[model samples]
Target: MSLVRKFATVASGTLMSRILGFAREMLMAAALGTGPVAGAFYAAFQFPNTFRRLFAEGAFNSAFVPLFAKEIEANGIDGARRFSEEVFGVLFSVLTVLTILMELAMPLLVRTIIAPGFASDPQKYELTVALATIMFPYLMCMSLAAMMAGMLNSLRRYFAAAIAPVFLNVILIAVLGHAWYTGADSLEVGYAMAWGVMAAGVVQLAIVWIAARRAGISIGFRRPRMTPNVKRLLWLALPAAITGGITQINTLIGTAIASGQDKAVPALAQADRFYQLPLGVVGIAVAIVLLPELARALKAGNDGEAASLQNRSVEFVLFLTLPATAALLVISEPIVRVLYERGAFTSDDTVLVSSILAVFGLGLPAFVLIKAFTPGYFAREDTKTPMVFAAISVAINITIALTLFPRMGAPGIAVASVVAGWANALMLLVVLIRRGHWGHDAPLMRRIPRLVLSSALMGAALYGGAVWLSPWLAPPASLLAQTGSLALLCAAGALVYFVLAFATGGADAGMVRRNVRRGSAAPAGTEE
Candidate 1:
């Protein structure tokens, strides 16, 4: 299958998960709002979520997938199987011990890493510790699941891994609904949600494990041993792991700063849900496909194909990113009002959260671009450069966040993140160009200017459109009317952007259509 199709498959699945995520957040807003309960739950949940990103999302794929694919290509299935078993043993054992230790140290973890501000409130502080302890084992489940996902992606089996998160969202939404129906208190709902997270993790793991079994790559654990291959995997993974830690550390700092004020943490979490929709669908979709494809291309000494792939990936990301950025930034207020301002969530809350969302919008393109560009380095087995850049970006974030949080609060923390994201992206680009790894194709150079201009045009349109649509999009309006009004606004913005995008040569509907058509004709079961 073409990389475009792979992207489409992964993105389609991600779109479902993101939609379900919106649903889950909407329910939470109605049920918990920006209350102390919501704040405590979000704060507690960050422990496992942080490690999931650190080990599974960021480090594991970069270090494992390329090496796994190399093993398959070089020494065949048996070799890959042996390596997988060893890694599985070590990963499971380490995560098991870590989970147990963290569970015992949950109070310290909550006090130091998550929400030190809550320490003043004994009830909130203790609740956070308990919830975090319950959720800690999820890290173990998801870390192992992520390895399965990497394996499936390397084998060109994208659907199972991509769809796994939908089940997670499905489970959480159901649990939240049950809690609401039972008229459970916020704390009860949080405990249910915490247990539900662990349950979803197990289901997701089983889904991927079954998929792997069907694909003739059943991975089972052996005795944990430091084999040469496992040592090499760890060696390569260390820098990537540090890079991932830097990413999570930035989040931790932002949350810590935001935790100082009431509702700040949940407000930022709401903003995150919106921005993450685009980042997950576009940035993550590109990153997943680009890495293994680039690795294979480089290994085959096919730099031209690798360059072309990189160019189109960047162009595609820019084309998709610009409009999402425009919508999120321009109509952010109405979007938040329509989606979240109901039940316990207030107009004042909408204002603050929307402002934070807009701040995050500024960094969206940079985030996606960073994802698009990094595969070049990861594919070449050079994790150290990104680790260094990530360190520098964290320093920038900490300095700016510390300076701004005193003055501007949660939005200030968000602004720091945006600035740091751009710094990381620019530094990565400069290094790529310097090392002769990046070649700016004509289409990329041409389309970027057009994409930016078209987005600016769309943003202006949305600003005016939002004003005209505000009455129906705000509180006291019926849900149907508000939804319809928001949809109309989106349709207008999408129409304007796509027309300008096509006119300016930033998008090619024809090419994507052809790819889809060809993709439709391919056999479903084959890797190709």
Candidate 2:
């Protein structure tokens, strides 16, 4: 498949997931608001999610896909199937044990790692621990899901795995909406949401499992044994896991610092939801789909093809991510207000969250680029290089967090994250260039100035629209006006960005149309 079609398939599924995620957050905002209950729920959600990134998405996928692809290329389908089964057995065993331990240790873990916000309020702290315990088991299910997802991506079955996350939001929204309709207390409804997280994990896992089966990759639990391949997988996974941990340390630091400020944690969380929309849809989807292809191309000694693929991935990411960053920065306020300003979510909360979203927006491209670039190293089986960069990024994040938290609070931490992201992206790019693995292709270089100009135009239009519409769409203290204004702002930004990107050379309509046409003619599973 052409890169564009691969990306489109992944991006379309991710867009569905992001939409559902938006709906889920909207329901959470309306159901719980930005109070202690909301804070507790967000904190609880972050606990499992942090590990989910560390294990399932970051570590496991990065380590698993390259190896699986190599096995498929070398020994064919049965060898790849055996490799997956072995990994699944070990992963399931380890994750089950880890989940039990995490659940049992939830209170202490929350006290140590997620304790900042709860220090002033003992009840909130305890509540977070309770909620975290209910949600911690999600890691086990999601870890298995990630393994399944890695297999699917290796097999080029991107649709189901990409779409599975939408189920998470769907389940959460259904649970919360049902509770609200039954007139449950806000706290009770929030707890129901927490439990719904676990249910979502089960559903995600099942969806991916079915996809895997359909792809002729059936995974089962055999007697857990550390075969040579299993050991090799673990060895690769260790550095990757540590890399994820180091990267997550920044988030932990932000959480620790944000915990001390009332509503800061949830504000950052809500802003992240918006930022992650583009990051997940474009950045993550590209990384997942590209890594295995890159790995196979490199392993087959197709350096030129690998280089071309890398260049296309960069172009694809830049083409989409540039405007997304601009739009988010432009429409941060309305996006937050429209989606989150409800029930207990006050106008003040909307302002605070939107400020953080803008800060996050500045780093959105950097974050997306990291996803685009890291696969270059991982596909080369060089995990440690990215780990080194991750360590530096973590240090940068920590320095900014400690230095700025006293004066700026949560927004400061958000800025720190953005700075860290840029630092990481630059470091990765520098290393890639130094190694001669990635360089500026003429096409990418030619597109840069026009892309910037287009983004600038979009930003200007969005800012002007925001200024003009502020009075009409200014977040009212009322939920209805807040929601309506937010929606208008987002619609305006989307219109402006799309028009500018099309008019400027930032988006090549002919090239995209040609690529899509070529992609349609290609058979499934035909790797370019």
Candidate 3:
């Protein structure tokens, strides 16, 4: 498949999951609002979710995919399968132990790492512990699932891994819908959502497991042993996991800091879910597809093709992310109102969430740029460089968040995260260039400024459009009217950006087509 085609497959699947995720959040807002229960639930959920990003998606994808692809190239299917089974055995054993330990230590974790602020309230603190214990095993399921996902990505089977997350949203939405219909209390809903998260992890893991089986890469049980390949994987994955999970780590810190303020946790989470739409669809989709393809190109000694792939992937990310950042900044209030300002979620909550959302918008491009740039290092087995950069970013995030959160509340934390993200992205890009792993492609250089200007213009248009449609997007408007107005604004923004992008030669259909064709061709000096 072409590179863009692969990206579309993953992005479309992610977009589906994200849309359902929004629905789930909307239901949650109505049921719980930014209440104490909501705070507990989001805090508990964030722990396992952060580990899933750190260990499963981040570590496994960064460390496992490149090695898995190399295994296929060097040892063929049998060797790859053996290696996979070996890693799975170790991963499963380690996760089982880790889950038990975490569950046992849930209370301590809650007080220390998850939410120190909650400790002052006995009800909230115990609730967070119980919820976290129930959900912590989800980390085990998702980590195992990520190993299989890495296998699938290496095999060029992107759909299953990408679409599997939809089940999480599906199950949670069902739980929330039931809670809403039955008029369950917020505490009841929190417990139900926690269990729903655990169940969803199992289902998501099964989906990818089955997909991997169908792809002819069934990995079965083996005794946990540290053979040469397994040891090598561990060595590589240790740093890569940290590097990959930097964003989550930063957010985790922010969450801990924000926990001091009532309703601040859910507010930040709500805002995060909004901006994550573009980040997941564009940044994550590009990263997932780019890594294995770039690794394969480099492994084949196709430097030109690898460089071309990096440039194009970055171009593609900017074309999507720049406009998204603009729209989120320009119309955050209306978007939050349309999505979550009903039921228990108040207009005051909307104002708070939207303000944080706008701050997060300023960092959208940086967040996505981190995704686009990290592969340049990971694809070359240089995980430590990114790891070092990630540590620096985390330190900066901590310092800034601690400094600001006391006075500024949740928006302060958001600012720290944004600044940290930009620091990380710029560091990665600079290192890539200084090390000569990346070249300055003329076309990419030319298009970036144009794309930025196009997004600025689009942002202005969206601001005017929002003002003109204020009545339709405000609280007095019906749900249909609000959603319709918001949708129209988004569509208009997209139209304006694309037209300007193409007219100004920032992007074009021909460029996309060429990338598609280029991706389909075999690397130079390599047989089909």
Candidate 4:
């Protein structure tokens, strides 16, 4: 399959998960609002979720996929299986120990890192600690699942890993539904949601595990040993983990800082969900597919093919994300109000979350560009460079967020993240070019400015449409009216962007067809 098709396979699955995720968040907002329970639950969830990204997505896969792909090429399936089992055994043992340690330290963690501000409220602090302990084991399940996912991706099977996240949303939504039906109190709902997260982790793990089995790789646990391969993996993974989870690190910093303000944690969480939809769909798909594809190309000594994959991945991400950034910036309030302003969620909450979403929108391109550029390093086993840059970005995020939190509140925290993201992304891109690892090819260079122009024009149209449709999007508007109006505005924005994109050759039918077609080579005329 071509890179685009592979991305599409993952993206389609991600889109499903994101849609269901929206439903889950909507129910969560109605159930908890931006109250103490909501803040506690989101804060508690952030710990395990951050670790999941760090261990599973950031560390394991960033380091594992390239190694796994190379293992298959050199040592074949049997070698790959043995290597996987070794890594799995070590991962399982490490996670078990870590979970126990974290559980014991939950109270301290909550008081210090997770949500220091919760310390003043004993009830909220206790709830956060308990919720985090309940969800902490989720890290083990997801890390193991990520290993399986890396194996699947290396084998060029994208659907199962990409689709596995749907179960998380599905399970959570079910828990919220039951809570709503029972008219549960906020505390009761919080406990139920944490358990639901635990259940979802198990379900998600089972999904990827079963998929790995079907792919003919049944990895049984082995005694944890310091084998050469395992040691090498650990070495590469340590830095890559930091690099992979930089966004999570920044968000965690923001979360801890935002925790100082009442309602700020949940408000940031809600805004995060909105931006994460696009990030997960485009950035994640590119990140997942690009690493393995680039590794394979470079392994075969096809430098041209590697460069093409990287360039096209960047192009594809920008093509989709720039428009999304525009929409989020132009109609953030209408979008937030339509989706979230209901039941316990008030209009004031809408205003706060919308502002945060707009700031996150400004960083959308940078977020996805990091995904596009990092494979250039990871594919060559140079995880440390990205790791160094990620650390710098984290420092930037922490300084700016702390400096601004007291004055600008949650939006300031959001701005800090955007700035950090752009810094991380540009650093990676510049290093790649300086090292002669990546180059801005002719097509990519030509298309980006045009894509930016198309998105700007689309944003202007969207702004006008939002103004014209204000009545249908306002308070007291029926849900159907608000949804319809938002949908119409989005459709109009997309039409304007795509028409202009094609007209000015920012994107073209030939490029789309080339991406969708089979094989990796760029056919003549694939680029204008």
Alpha carbon lDDT at 367, candidate 1: 85
Question: Candidates' lDDT values, in order?
Answer: 0.87, 0.81, 0.92, 0.92
Candidate 4 on 1-528: residue-level lDDT in tens? 777878988999999999999999999898788999999999999999999999889987799999998998899889999999999889888999999999999999999999999999999999999999999999989999999999988888888899999999999999999988998999999999999999999999999999888887999889999899999999999999999999999999899999889999999999999999999999999999899889989999999888878888888999999999999998999999999988899999999999999999999999999999999999999999999999999999999999999999999999999999999999998889998888668877888999999999999999998989999998778899999999998998999999999898899987787567665543232211
**lDDT for position 139 in model 4:** 92
Per-residue accuracy of model 3 over 1-528 as CA lDDT, tens digit each:
788888898999999999999999999998899999999999999999999999889988999999999998999878899999999999999999999999898999999999999999999999999999999999999999999988888888888999999999999999998987898888999999999999999999999999988878888899999999999899889899999999899999998988899999999999999999999999999999999999999999999989888988898899888999999899999999999998899999999999999999999999999999999999999899999999999999999999999999999999999999999999999989998889779888999999999999999999999999999998677999999999999999999999999999899787778667746553332221
User: lDDT tens string, model 2, 367-411?
Assistant: 888888888988988888888888888889989898998899899
Select the stronger candidate by TM-score from 1 and 2. 1
Relative to the unseen true structure, what is the C-alpha lDDT of residue 414 in candidate 3, on a scale of 0 to 100?
97
By lDDT, the best candidate is 3
Q: Which pairs clash in the backbone of model 3?
A: none
Query: What is the model-wide C-alpha lDDT for candidate 2?
Result: 0.81
**TM-score for each candidate, following the candidate numbering:** 0.97, 0.94, 0.98, 0.98
Candidate 4 clash pair list: none
Q: Candidate 1's residue-wise lDDT over 363-394, tens digit each?
A: 99988888888888989989999989988999
Alpha-carbon RMSD, candidate 3:
2.2
Global local distance difference test of model 1: 0.87
